[model samples]
Target: MKTYRYLDLITALFVVVLIVSNVASTKVVLLGPFTFDGGTILFPLAYIFGDVLTEVYGYKRSRRVIWTGFFLLMLAALTFGLVNLLPTPADPQSQGTAQAFSTILGLVPRIVLGSLVAYWVGEFVNSFILAKLKIATQGRWLWVRTIGSTLVGQGLDTGIFLLIAFYGVWDNSLLWTVFVSNYVFKVGVEVLFTPVTYAVVGFLKRREGEDYYDRDTDFNPFALGR
Candidate 1:
């Protein structure tokens, strides 16, 4: 393994925030009569960072970050489960708080699984496509690669997450609507942030003295030993 850099730590922290915010965002509420999960606001940032990691550091480093996120998510879910399983105080107020905590934390397993699977799938796809496009285009047309990869990657992430998390629970039509709408919203966020993404990628590459091309990378998601 290579020596750790300070920015890598920052990247890891952002990944954790992304996972936590994603799990917490499942609660739907009305925003001007349009119902949406709070997760929508934070989830796109994960993809943006995903793009940054892959673009600046390469697939191997990005894979490490992804796996770091995976373990952190698992630890969080396990901690939540353990906390929820412990006995609560007898006071009615305490009991209510415990119940609320349990209700939120109890969804950890499913949500964690959905997030892990979607993230692994979507991120790898995004990185792989972008890496290949970078080589094919000789690193020209950054916007096309970023937007194109997000279109496919976010689509897969949205579809997989919705199907796994709410398959039989939601009617097919409603499920499809949710999936499509979330996909559009996520991709829209990516599109809107393209300029920021460009700036960040450029700054990171210059500061880190690395604009990696994964020409020799092993694209396997499970090959974390790289």
Candidate 2:
């Protein structure tokens, strides 16, 4: 296996974003017209990280990073769940803390499963689309690839996650509102960060001497290959 100067760093950051997003998702918030989980603000960055990883390191490397995040997130969820199940101290000062902790970090099986499935599917779709577009366009326009892939990826991500996580628990209207709002917000983040993405992609390519195109690469998400 070959190593790059910053691939590890980028992968670390990517996993951090994913784990934090999962933890933050416990809160539902309304920001103006948008009703979404607190994670909405941070989850978009995970997609951006996906774009950069696929663009600079190729889909193979990005796939590995995605799996890394997946397993780590599952581990985090399990850890939280176990901690939430433990009996609290009997002291007066800590009496209510257990309930608060459970309220915030207690794992809901449906939500955790939904998040994992949605992320797995959505990220692969995003990486696959961007890689294909890069080849088709001969790498002419970065914005087209980034924004276009995100439009589709985030749509499936937002819809699947919300439906699975909230279908029975939330009213139909609320579900639709969240799906639309989250989709728009995520795509908006991609568009807003296009310039920054360009800068980072260009810098990484030059410095790391890698601008991977998946012309001969495997698209299998399970194949962690070199």
The C-alpha lDDT values of all candidates are: 0.79, 0.92
Q: How accurate is candidate 1 locally (lDDT)?
A: 0.79
Q: Which residue pairs collide, candidate 1?
A: none
CA shift of 139, model 2, Å: 0.8
Model 2 segments more than 4 A misplaced:
none
What is the Å distance of residue 221 in model 2 from its true position? 0.8
**lDDT digits (tens) for residues 66-159 of candidate 1:** 7777778777778887888889889999999999887776664666677778877888898888888888888788888889989999999888
Q: Estimate each model's TM-score.
A: 0.91, 0.97
In model 1, which regions exceed 4 Å deviation?
Answer: 1-6, 30-35
lDDT of 2 at 115: 95
For candidate 1, give the lDDT of residue 120. Answer: 75
